[model samples]
Target chain A: MRIICCVKHVPDTNAQIQLAANKKDIAREAISYVMSPYDEFAVEEALRIREKNPGTTVAVITLGPERVDQVLRTGLAMGADEAIHILDPDSSITDPLIVARCLAQVIKSGGYDIVFCGRQAVDNDAFQVGSAIATMLNVAGMTLAGKVEVDANAKKVKVERIVEGGTRQIISGSFPVLITAQKGLNEPRFASLPGIMKAKSKPVTKKNAAELGVDLNTKMIIELLEVPVYQRKKRVIQAGEDGKSAVKQLIELLRTEAKVLE
Target chain B: MNILIVAEVSQGKVKRASLEVLTRAREISAGGEIAVALAGAYSADAEKTLARFGAGKVFYTDHDQVSRQNPEAVFELAKMCAAECKAGLILLGASFLGKEVAARLSAQLGAPLANDCIEIKTAGNGVVVQRPMYAGKVIATVQLGGAQNIVSIRPNSCVAKESPAEAQAKKISLDSVSLKTSVESLEIAPLKRPELTEADIVVSGGRGMKGPENYNVIEALADKLGAAVGASRAAVDAGWRPHSDQVGQTGKVVSPKLYIACGISGAVQHFAGMGSSKCIVAINKDAEAPVFKKCDYGIVGDLFQIVPLLTQELSNSRD
Candidate 1:
């Protein structure tokens, strides 16, 4: 059995985000980058499935600048058999569909039975790419899968989705199923010294859109990004001798300014 | 202008988030038709509750396929209802189900969808929605490009307002013959006492809580105040708590009336999850803890000593 996990290199969520002086985009001068937090679940799950079912291969694919190779290496260190980097070093694309198109090309020819992605990238927080890819591929897809069980013998898959207010479980008929893993799907293992050494020797394949018959120059345009205005910054109304007095003042602000309370 | 709400019901029960959406819809678009597109196997009790919350017309789709939580099926049904009612705006709760369904529905209907919105208002030419970006550090006003505006409001962001309107709804059922997916299995989490996001008061612990067994302080205080137990990413990563209880950028985003931090030196990601809370009370031995900056009240003392006293005082006051 073969599983393909889709991952992305994003700005390290732990870093402080500063709006560019132009207010159009995020300033990227000194920001560090890493694999998205949710994708960690997907990558870890793929590794475990390969380990549990000996003779299975796991492949990690990502679309981003050349720096994305670092995330691929991280996955290789964790246990992936191969890594595919669809390098668009010019920083030209931002649309989820474009990302999905690149993935669809890889999935169509890669001969993988299953595909996985983190529910959503914390950077964009759009939650659209996986489902969009499923739509493009015309295959069964499940988002926010809390648990998954593969029936290798019967060629079927059962997945439980974490929905609002409750959960929904669904089973798919065959391979080519796309799923997004939720947190707690598996405990992502730390890279060992031997594994890191072996990762350096693993094959890291670079495929551009033109090489894959996709237009790398095609870009999705985004309007200027703006941050919300905050007149008050880090000013907490410390509790005085009477806590009730502080609460009263807070109520007044909520009523008049925030207008959230009645 | 008309406000349309997708009345989300599962297994014949109306979700609290749907009621919360109705309240928000009313606040944004004052006194509109408030039409509700009700799908799934809704019971009679659920229909009446939908009407009680100012739903002028309840377009019911009682198809078995609609009963399943498939985004394509639900979006098809919602699109038909929106067209039938000629609604100017459609509001859905930005829960896990709502986000995907709303996105596909908007795509199919050629309408713009503003996702996980905290606020929505009728702006000139369209509706302007406010959503938190960059993990709650900044809010952005997202504009949808279409004739009819569609938005998914984030759950737990708005409280349900009760202004009972007496309007008997017209139920309409659709053909359920062509369905895409089927529910195969279900494994429910053991019903814990409190849902993390719904709790009015939340008492969260961190690595400073010491060990998994020492989480008793959080549980005790949470129990006394009828609150839910939460944990920081550090605690969850350390295997001291379940990932389900983790609150941070990767974890659940929550806003409660009161949030108490025990032994937690707040990280930016952790604060992003619960920073918008009504009142924050921090307890840490380190006076220089970052949590003190975001907290409304701070106690510079050991959580081991202060938690017990606070739990006892709260329990006594409740009695």
Candidate 2:
């Protein structure tokens, strides 16, 4: 069995985001980057699947510049057998389709049975690449998988995905499919000292978009970027000794001043 | 230019989000023909409803594939409709099925896509879309740079208005093609509360709620206000609420008319999910909690006391 998890290096969730001077992108400097949280779940799930079935090889793939090597090494420490880096010349590409196409071009030659991608990248918040990859490869695309059950012998798997309004769709499909990871899929483990040392010796293959025959043109262009402005009243009614009066005043304001309530 | 609005019908009722997209489409269509694809089993009232929302043509299908809300099926149907209508742009609500289908359709057609758009407009010969990135902390105005465009809009981003017009209804045929992956069963949660994304008003709890069982107070307030229940990431990680209820950068982003934060400190991530709401109210015991600084109204009091009292007041004042 062969599995590949596509990971991305994004700004940490806790980092304060600010627009760059260009106003079309965020400030890249002074921001710490980590593996996207959902991608952590994908890599963790891939490792768990490899553990359940012997002779399974788990590999991690990423498309970025030199900085992406950190995420790939972390994936190696998490028990992936190898790493594939498609040296992306443009990290500022806002178009998810080109990313999907570049990754698909490489995965097509890898002969992997299953592919894992995060539900959405936290940085761009675009939930397109995972399914777009599936489309590009013409693979059975299952998204937002909160729970996965694989039957390697039958070459099939069953997935329970959470949709809106709290509905869970139980779906079963054959191997050679794409699964987008959702939260609660699994708890990712930290790399131990020995694993980190071992990862240093693992093979890290690097390729570029030109060699892969992938196009680098962007379709969606960011015209402008700005910090979101909020017109919050920031009004605080002190409860004082009379909490009820404060509650009454707030309710009245909601009904009349803000007119949020009838 | 021709535009196709894909509508989702659940149990003979059109998804309100779809109508919202159609309404937005009617606004920015710019003298272009607006068509609708109401594939699978839907009601006549739905067809009429589409016409009332400025759909000049309604194309529907009952193929075995499209009835299940499967991504592959809907993608096929939409691809066909785009060609039939000669659509230069396609719009779908960013619902569970809509997002997946829109993604695939855009990739297959090689159209530039703008997903989760809050606003879209036609400027000169090109189209412009505005969306939030970095979890709504940064807003991006993007330009679509292709012959065709695919846009999936967020629910409740636009309000549906009636603009009755004559709609030429027709039926389209699709083959029974499955993606080799099929749903065995659907387990719908019994909770009938409004979905967080679609609700006009939202009431959310956080670590201040303390325990899972204490959500009843929050739920009581939500029930009275008829708002969806939301939870901050802190509450979800502690297993006090389901992941679907989580509202933050890692969770669902909501834009409701009224957002009541019960015992939730206004972290940037949490605010990113719902900072666009029209009104925000916070109730917490801590005077210095960050929520007060970011809310339209704040009451420095115990949620245990304030929530129930607010619920009682709302119930008494109900129309």
Best by TM-score: 2
C-alpha positional error of residue B24 in candidate 2 after TM-score superposition, expressed in Å: 1.5
Query: Model 2: what TM-score?
Result: 0.97
CA lDDT, every model vs. true structure: 0.73, 0.88
- What TM-score does model 1 achieve against the real structure? 0.83
lDDT digits (tens) for residues A1-262 of candidate 1: 8898899888887887777886556887898988888899998988877877888899999988887899998889988989999888776666555677778777778878778899888877767667666655656677777777887777667776655324445644456677888887877787788888999999988888556776433222234466543222233444444344444454455446544334
Each prediction's DockQ against the real complex:
0.25, 0.81
Query: Which portions of model 1 miss their true places by more than 4 Å?
Result: A52-56, A86-92, A101-111, A161-173, A191-262, B1-4, B10-13, B27-34, B63-76, B79-89, B106-112, B123-125, B147-150, B162-181, B186-194
Return the lDDT, model 2, position A243. 74
Predicted candidate 1 versus true structure: per-residue lDDT over B156-231, tens digit per residue:
7878877677655665555643433446654344545456766677889997898999998889878767778899
Query: Candidate 2: how many backbone clashes?
Result: 0
**Cα-based TM-score, every candidate:** 0.83, 0.97
Q: Output the worst ten-in-a-row residue range by lDDT, candidate 1 chain B.
A: B179-188
For model 2, residues A12-108, the per-residue Cα lDDT tens digits are 8878898788887789999999889999999999999999999999999999888889999999998899999988667655589888888999998
lDDT of 2 by residue, B1-319 (tens): 7899889886677888998999998888878999998844657888998888889998888865566566777788888889999998899998868888889997899888888999999865557999888889888899986788988899998889989989998888775455667777666677579999999999999999999999999989998888999999999999999899999999999999999999898898899999999999999999999899899999999899888988887777774
